[model samples]
Target: MKKILLSIGGLVLLVIAVLLVAPLFISLEDYKPEIAAKAKEATGRDLEIGGKISLSLFPTVAIEVNDVALANYEQGQNKDMVTLEQMALELQVMPLLSSEVVIDRFVLVKPIINLEIDKTGKPNWELEGTQAPANETATTENSESSDGGSGAGLSGLSLGDVRIENGELHFIDLASGAKEDIEALNLEISLEALNEPLSLDGRLDWKAETINLKADVANLESLMNGGSTALEASVNSSPVNFSFNGTAQQASAFALAGALDLDVPSVKGLTDWVGAPIERQSEETFGPLSVKGQLDLNGSVVAFDDVSLAFDALTAQGALKIDSSGSVPNIVAALSTGVLDITPYLPPETSGGQDASSESTSDGGGAVQNAGADQGWSDEAIDFSGLKSVNADLALKSEGVKIRKITIGVSELGILLQGGKLTADLKQLALYDGQARGKVVLDSSKATPTTAINFDLSGVQAEPLLSDSADFEKLLGTLSSKANLTTQGASQKAMVSNLNGTGDFIFQDGAVKGVNIPGLIRNVSLDALQNSFDEAQSTDFAELSGTYTIQQGVVNNQDLSMIAPLFRLSGKGTVPMPPKTLDYRLEPKLVGDLEGQGGDSGAKGLAVPLLITGSWSDPKVAPDLAGALTDQLKDPSALIEGVTSGEGGVKLPLGDGDDAGGVEEVIEKPKEALQKLFGN
Candidate 1:
């Protein structure tokens, strides 16, 4: 029995030796033509196979090809369009025993694929007029056959291990002049077949610039066929080091189910990647961005959570969701920052003196003055013409943004701001004082791009408003006011012409300094003329009430009056606020009691029934009043010196002088006294 067992074992060993050594006698060159013919029949192209086959062991096969070239046979041109070089394959030993061929390993090296799209936008590779092969058939007889059935059996090839080393791939769009190249590529793959389904594990390494990426992918085949695949990748460089992990089928689907981790040395670099316009000339630089996030994707909808990004210049972190299912993609994103420097994004000023002069002259002579309190306006107001909606939670720490031609309208109020600037703690919408807090709303609905503002301002200094104007020199006291102003039209000049608004203004402890309204009134005083006022009132007393209209810096008052002991006064005038000049005509009336007191009352009323007058710009009160008083009292120096030295009140002295003279003389001279008092 032992001898018989030994003989059986020796026979089995001999059979294995014969099976392993038989392929060594089979010449690999003899199979080249058959391999080429099989590839051509399968791909519908001319194929060149230059590879050596190895069969040193039973049921195991290996093919190493130096180069394999495929050509488009439909073109009549004999040039090879696609080439595979240094290709190799290794097969499992078990498939040979089953009369079936299954590849366990496949590898490609330096494969160059060239594709051309003609002017007609047709790719050269597409089969022009060929019919597709009929559906494949399966039979038990072919399955049992040793030669792997028929010539059409190549489709059944299954690979278990695949790798590409030191390869280069390029995509060129011929018609668009666009080219994309990937170089220095290396890849390794391991896969297995289960229930006729392929499962793969992959590792890839690539480089571009100083950046290097290493990635691991799992379930790669399933991922290509609408099943989930998981991937984790890490990038390293001097300025950047980041990692990310997620599951995705395609790049577009990354927005749905991808998680990204970033630790970059510069936020500016990230901004550049995301397409924000940051000026290259700015001196300000941002530090690194540290970000981590996860994305949930559902077709065209994507939602992001656990998103956080930080920079040295600002702290920005937020969640965002995007919907691309509509005609126009809509993005709803919320971002908040601890601090941000947005100066780089601000509009650049127009250079050269010509632009400055043009802007200065465009206001139609309305003057702008420097603020006494330094409201922190570094540049001129921006022109709000083409601005759309702005939705950002921003904290700004610079000066402030100036807006020109701010036309605003609410239901009851309308205003036009020529050149106004406002400064606020933007994050809180509060002034530095903390008491003043408000939001500004601008509406440009009427004219697509025209700006209209509706704002509620409180606890603001009134002096800032007057200081911004060219006319008034200074204003005293703190002021708080709320207004709603709007204007129509496009530009500052045009808006003023078409401007219409109504606002109620109130002042507390407000006083105008370096402005002498009394002097102006005296220069245009009606005391020199007859029938100015019907009643006899003290010269020291005066009251004014009427609607005044200003146009092109000229003020016109239609109904004005003045009362004096000897005469009543009335007049009309054109007063220019800037440059401070006026022209007027006055008529004086004798008082009834004064006429009853003496026969000369009619003479007083008759003197200078109308006086025409003009005055200098911004005249000094003391000198102007001295001139008028010298003309009326025949002793100007006394009254002028009296008021200038603070010895006596000028208005009361003039009133006493009016009582001393007859009604006629008093009425005539009081006008001179008024002229002296007002420096007109």
Candidate 2:
């Protein structure tokens, strides 16, 4: 035993002497080629050492290597995969006597690492003949037992300080054409225990933004071994500031609980700082934001509780969860707010701040001009791709909501998303002193996106609703309506071309201005019709109801009816949505006829068929003389007897022109008998 001990001590002294004296006796550069050859044989990559290599023996033994590089993979475009300006490892001399390896400090300077995955989805780090994880694990265990190893190799291992200065890491994905670079990274760590806690301080340059961070970890070894650890972290920067106190686990056995705080001066500015900026049509400041939340996460699921977010003029609180364990992510949330203002998200209001009622003129001229100018419904394509991004169910409530002149009071809305479909349910909506309920669903599961809306609104003001919804302000009353509609399209015009729906509407105690049906049906001239069709000549109705069906964007109203004191009107019409036009024929007759019963054109007391035709905003109403003539002559025998023999009925007065006598001759060759009956 003494001989063995003496021999080991002598060997240790010899190694110490060599470490101290070698650099002076020999040039290390002479062995560089052999060292490079061994490294290449082991790693299958080129190794270059352009700078000095040195060894020291003092309070601590140390080795330093400078200006080293490794060759890249065969598929990489660059020649070098990694390069280092300097690297050093220091060891405690006392540990060597006990057969223990204890590191005093580790340092790296100006290191650059490049990592990549190729188009074939193979990472550059993957090596040929690499053992599977199970095999690797068994091999490691067998090797350790055979070598009679202590834990972590030569047991009593300890490390004090670790420092990295001016480092860079780059990751590239050739398939996705994505490149991420982290530059000017520096890290400093102070260790308190070998396995329990680590104090970290770090900073980096990202997208020209400086990020300073600090973190403390307890049980870092446990985390590395797929277990839980406690963490506290904070980040400070110009674009955003964030902090968290949490328990974090590994990705496979994921678990997290934390409190998070975040602040941002402007969302747009923050996005720009990250090298991506949103493109929006409206020019407005998007946000000055603050957020606070309690987070709990397990596996592929994440949840936030007691969450509050304040951005711009909107303040909201919610509980939110996202589950990504499935084929696609699912998100569920419920949020509530007070006085939500969505004005900035809309297109700038054209007739800004003008009273809604003032958009129309009594003469109906301005209505046409305005409608033509605006041509409602934008032609720009609406991207619905976001609806398919995740499956979600969300509920939102607000005390009040406003978007330009449109306002809603006490509203609750729910949104559901799944399988590339999104449904928005207005479970409760109070607007314009009324209530509304509806469901709107957008589905992209088909070849093209399709939408369905089923809605009911009651006790709503007609004029304001129309003005806000469709820029129409011609009618005033309380309205009730129900509609079920479906359409498929990528744009407004496409939707119009494929629209299909059914709806019914009832207006109570309403008045429609700018046209007089009775006067126009009385065979009045155009000038006379326009004169009496002024605002003062509006027709008042006790009840007006219509049931309509829409096919291919053309709305057909076949059961249109109106009740008034002096007249009862029934009409039918087609409103073609794409052209923004209306065509209708209304048959209006007096309340009582000679038989003391209401009648149509034949039973008479000025039952004229009034035709309304024109652009929707400026329709023209006139007496259909040609149609009346056609109806009058449907029985040619009756027309011959009424004009010639005066047996069918007395001929209705034809016109205010002197050609009244010539009217009979105009139909045929100057019928002498008809001319004599008219005394022509």
Candidate 3:
């Protein structure tokens, strides 16, 4: 029996010897033409083998080739689809008997691959006459292999030294004129066996950035055979760093569930590196960004739970899902944050000087600081094109929020965007000590965009709200307001000109900051009227209420009423928003004595009509002396009665200063009293 086993072993040794010496007798170069012809017949492209090819068999079966190239499609942009400087492969012979592939060495040096898509969407990689038959065979094989019954498949595989040095891959799309080149790619891969861990480390230069990548798969065979395996991967570059620890599987489609961490030192830098730049409103926007999450991705859908995101000065935690199976990607998220400061993402405030007063105003919530026709509003077209890119439903809650100069507290908002229309619903909002509920809709689906806003606010501090929104700090109060407004346009001026709305506001225990109605009436001089906007000349009011309607950019208010200690004030006006001009008239009736006593007596002292005109930035104030004199001319005796007893009609104080004897002299000749009082 020992002799028989020795004889079998000796036969095996003889066979191995013959295999080792086989290459000595046969020249692989002689068959290079046949190999090239076969490849050309299969792919319908020229194959050139320019250098030597050698083969060996002993400890391992090996083949090495140099200078090989394959031609691209005739109409392709590149002449050669692939070019290789050198390639070597080694396989362990003993592993074949056990249905295993053990690669001792597999190295590719200086390999260049060029992939392209023509303008007609034809890819150079799609070899001629290879699609239908290859797909059919793959489908049949996949179906047979689904039951794990394919004997032709390897049972185990191992890679010893697999390396790629200085490899390059280039992709060009003719239709989009986009080109991507990945050069200076060096890679090393290792695997013990099919079920053993596989590791890969590589570096590549892409888009002027050097990227280092590392990956590990716990079981490479399981992953390839429609099973799950543990995976860890990291990619590091100057612009960004990303790492993932996950379980990956490929059954019907590739799927991954993982913990992912990504950090971008500058999102703007990343975008610029990737050849896509974002337009930022401020220098601080789109700067640093980071994300950490538990992520699950299945084909076209990706979900993130326990996700924390930080961008610029904003930080939030959320559960987010994005599904790209539809025409437009759809995102659903629920996020909450401590304080969300969005000012960095807003456009900078307009700067310059105004004509008279440097104050601004707002209608609804749109700041009209630059809403005038000539120089106020910007003529640049507002672009809403990005709204059509995706759809989203987002629920956000924040302890506090800051947008531009306005600060809000304890806010809950729901945002829904679909078909180029975005709606934001303020569920719970606190702003400047006020509670507000509102909904804003922006529809960009049409040629001309449209916006609609409805808001109700109560118990709001008016001073800060106005100051923040419009840079106007003239009014102070606790305010309650309601507004329903709509506009359609593509620019600030056009939108404001098209604005139409109805609103009402009521203020309690407030003072007009820059005007003293009682003092203006008492002095009865042009100088007093001109200086009415002085900061020290404020008139305190117990209550102020007004209702207004807007039409074609003109706000018309006819019921402005204020109850003050020295006078009852009423106003009617038209403010044209497009021009930022005011044509308002305010009437102050002195109902109380100079000592503040006649408020309850119902005695009418005097009525002064004041006209406010010019730009909202620099309004002019003057008394309507002509109108007052007309009333006196009609009722001369009534003027005398009012001047003497402070009762019957509109009265005029004669002297520039407040003196009772001046009224007595004016009472004798009321017409002469009016002329002297007016300086006529």
Candidate 4:
């Protein structure tokens, strides 16, 4: 029995030895040529395969490939040139149980690729080309294999570890003439093709002249029959050091959709990376337009936190939102700041043009004439609906600057400027001590642009406001004024309709400055004029209050009063801006009933009556002395018959009875004759 058992044991050992050593005769070197031929046939290109194979007594087989390279082939190009590096596959056990191959690891290293795009934006790789005979045969075989089962081609392969080192990827932007290259990438993947689900992890490093990036990806998978892919990735770059992780889903070819959340600590570097300058502007210095902030973006939705931009003396910070998905996108942004000098960015005005104050002419004369008629405004009409929303805070400061906000709808009637605020600090504006605040709204819906203006003007010394403007210095002494005004109109012609406002005017001690009634009256006291002419020139006072209203081109002043002259005045006139013309009539009345009072019964006791009637085209001022003289001397010609004409007063002749009409009908008269003879 012992002898029989030993012989049985020996037989069992012999069978095991044969099973382990059988693969040794299957030399991998001998199979290299056939494998290379098959690979060439499959890819339509030449293939080179090299590797070492080993068999162990444990009944295991392992193979390692040093390198595999493929050649590029075209109808007339050099077919021997290497175009791509073939993947090196390493198998630890071949034909596991004699039916499938199990790959323990695979590595792809330092592969170079080239791509070219033509002027027509087509890629060279997409062009049709001839295929080698071996490649055609291999492709036919692969198709037959696929027909055997849905995944039969890849079902026999299993991998434990896969890695790629120092790989490079590049992208060329044909439209922008830019090329982006990513290099120094390392990746590791473990996949089992026959398994239910697949997984992968990769890491990459990218270097460029102005930027550097490193990223990591993990837990990648394709689920629901390739309808969705899930993964987590983090990317870090020198410019905008931030990271994002998310899941993405795709719907056939319609779209690639996903949502990603991110956190960013600082965007200063990011701004710099994008070639945005960082600096500030001073009164004597100019600075970069810099901005920094934390932003969140999900698909088309974006949000900002603590964002600011500095341009010269202006700094603006705000939050805004845009929706760019519709036919007409809209934008809603709110920004605020203390002061801003926006003059540098304003459009250059045409030469020899009328200023803001000049009424708009049919030829586009006012400031709003060519306001936004430029390419910049036209390009801003792109739809922004794809952008979500934003909220922000901001500030700006500048001298001689105008802040304007205008909105125009593509299909709307006209442009609407919600408002505009202007500040002038130039010496000419007297803004050194001058400051003005105002808001103007324009409604262009009408055939003409209608404007509403509300403004507060202060620190305007009358002398300066009128210095270069007119002859105010000749009549009124040094003067200053403060006024609050509101007006609405569609055009110069329409401005006369229902215009009303009030003003407080003050004149310093000096000779009457302008040609107005108050300026001409000087320091005359009615009582003193009646008492003796002595005290009339000694008194000095300055101040006035008045309100004016306009309707149907006629301006009327009901509360015109002055202290130095101590007189009350009423006036009416028409002021049209087109041809720039003014016509008015004024009646001056003494404050008290001097005729009834026990005042001096002299020329001063008589009412100091005055009348003004003239067109701005050519104005004339004279005294109403017709009733002052007795019947025999009542005629102005008789009163001035012997008086020598001087600079202060003059006299002229009167008409004969047949041709002379009523008192109002007398035509020619000397201005001085009326002033001296009537004492007004």
On TM-score, the candidate that comes out on top is: 3
- Quote each prediction's TM-score: 0.56, 0.78, 0.86, 0.42
Those runs of model 3 whose alpha carbons end farther than 4 Å from true positions after fitting are 1-10, 75-78, 118-121, 129-152, 279-284, 355-381, 446-449, 489-494, 578-580, 593-605, 614-620, 631-680
Q: Write the per-residue lDDT of candidate 3 for residues 181-286, one digit (tens) a residue.
A: 9999999999988788999999999998999999999987788788899999999999999999999998888899999999999999999999899999878889
Query: Which regions of candidate 4 deviate over 4 angstroms?
Result: 1-87, 91-103, 127-161, 170-176, 188-219, 222-231, 245-680
Question: Candidate 4 residues 631-654, lDDT tens each?
Answer: 325454433332322222221122
Q: Arrange candidates by TM-score, highest first: which order?
A: 3, 2, 1, 4
User: Model 3: how far is 250 from its true place, Å?
Assistant: 1.5
Candidate 3 is scored at a TM of 0.86
Clashes of each: 29, 0, 3, 42
**Candidate 4 weakest ten by summed lDDT:** 407-416
Tell me the lDDT of model 1 at 119: 49
Residue 332 error, candidate 4, Å: 7.4
Each prediction's whole-model lDDT (CA):
0.47, 0.73, 0.81, 0.41
Ranking by lDDT: 3, 2, 1, 4
Best by lDDT: 3
Model 2: per-residue lDDT, tens digit, 291-317? 899989898898999999998888999
